[model samples]
Target: MLKDVPRSTSFGHSSSVGTMELIRPRASKSNAIRIRRSGFQDFRRVGRRENDPRYYRFTLKRSGRIDISVQNREFGGFLGFPTPTLKVRLERSNGKVLNRRTVRGGEFGFISRRLDRNTTYYIRISSSGESVPYRLGLRTRGGAELFR
Candidate 1:
């Protein structure tokens, strides 16, 4: 049975797309919704860059699942920048960690277990001192769709 989920949320220097309110009420089988955000450079303060982390919050309105992955597109010091690095964490809204992993270079994948309905989850993405442009993708059993 489908249930109502909360849509109101607060974002800290981040953008959301696709299932903006997380997962929508599943009327019928559909393609996997994808949300993407680019974090090339964080803001700078007092002549120093702030190491603030990016956040993506979503709710599972049903027994749906998603595969989370990230990729660093910057490479070869093309712009005289260091190799891209990424660190991602998936956790419950209450601070219970579900998955945590780091990718020194290239793409990193983390598949989530079947999520319970009415539960809220968060995906946090942060970079080391060396920052570069990166992309985050979420896929599900239903085909594949991308959202800016």
Candidate 2:
């Protein structure tokens, strides 16, 4: 028999796809989801009211390189609608954008930067037109040592 898990207790719960894990966290004030060190790839819908800009945050355990990618999930368009363009931005905790890219449906946008340890960073995703689903990926390389 399966047991029911309380929604409040579902923090850190994840499902896997290949080497990526899908993280689902409770919505916060900024709706920012925290990305773990192992990294995560999440599927989300954006551009509609209330969810126009999706936010994600992560802090480096140590100095390392971070790579972020975003792509439209509805390839070749869903139903008869054309695929919506996606805008992905990498920003500092203070809201300064480090990089930005506009990616069409079925294409990928990526940004890579060397980040400092214990510093917070944010990824912002939005749609150019109608609301659409998208996949956002975050990966970290190098700097295995954790700060004391």
Candidate 3:
């Protein structure tokens, strides 16, 4: 019975011939860089020029309170030089300012705000003069996810 069974066969040969191009998504036009996680982010140098601000973007994984602290590095303290003041602002994605604080070098400027989950937020840091090194600390409460 097996020998007598009829078998089907294809008369044409198959070939996979085509051009493939991988297209990656373009980066956002805005200069803001995404913050992957919540914690201390140290900026070695910011605001190299006067009035220039560095912007960072982040999305909360859950609804909760966010506490932001910006501390300017005080390298001139021993020399008795005046501490630099850093202006930090928390804003919505659309550029609406939510909170602003001015912090001096060696001290932290803190901003506490309740934010919604899955919403985009921005942090703008500008130095009063020249360039300055700083540390940014992020804390979240009420089970809100920050960073990765």
lDDT of each: 0.53, 0.75, 0.75
List candidate 3 stretches off by more than 4 Å: 1-29, 49-51, 77-81
As for lDDT, the candidate ahead, 1 or 2, is 2
Q: What is the lDDT of candidate 3?
A: 0.75
lDDT of 1 by residue, 45-104 (tens): 110132335666656544455677666554574566556566778878788988887765
Give lDDT tens digits, candidate 2, residues 64-113: 78888887875786687777798888888888889999988888888988
Model 1 TM-score is 0.55
Q: For model 3, how does the per-residue alpha-carbon lDDT over 1-148 read when each residue is reduced to its tens digit?
A: 0123333347555544454434323223176777877674756556653225777788888988888888888556567768777888999888889999988878878899899888789988887766778888887887888647
Model 2, global lDDT: 0.75
Error of 1 at 22 (Å): 31
Tell me the alpha-carbon RMSD of every candidate. 15.6, 12.1, 19.4
Error of 1 at 41 (Å): 18
Which regions of candidate 1 deviate over 4 angstroms? 1-51, 77-84, 142-148
**Candidate 1 residue pairs in backbone clash:** none
Residue pairs of candidate 2 with colliding backbone atoms: none
RMSD of 3: 19.4
Predict model 1's lDDT versus the native. 0.53
Work out the TM-score per prediction: 0.55, 0.70, 0.70
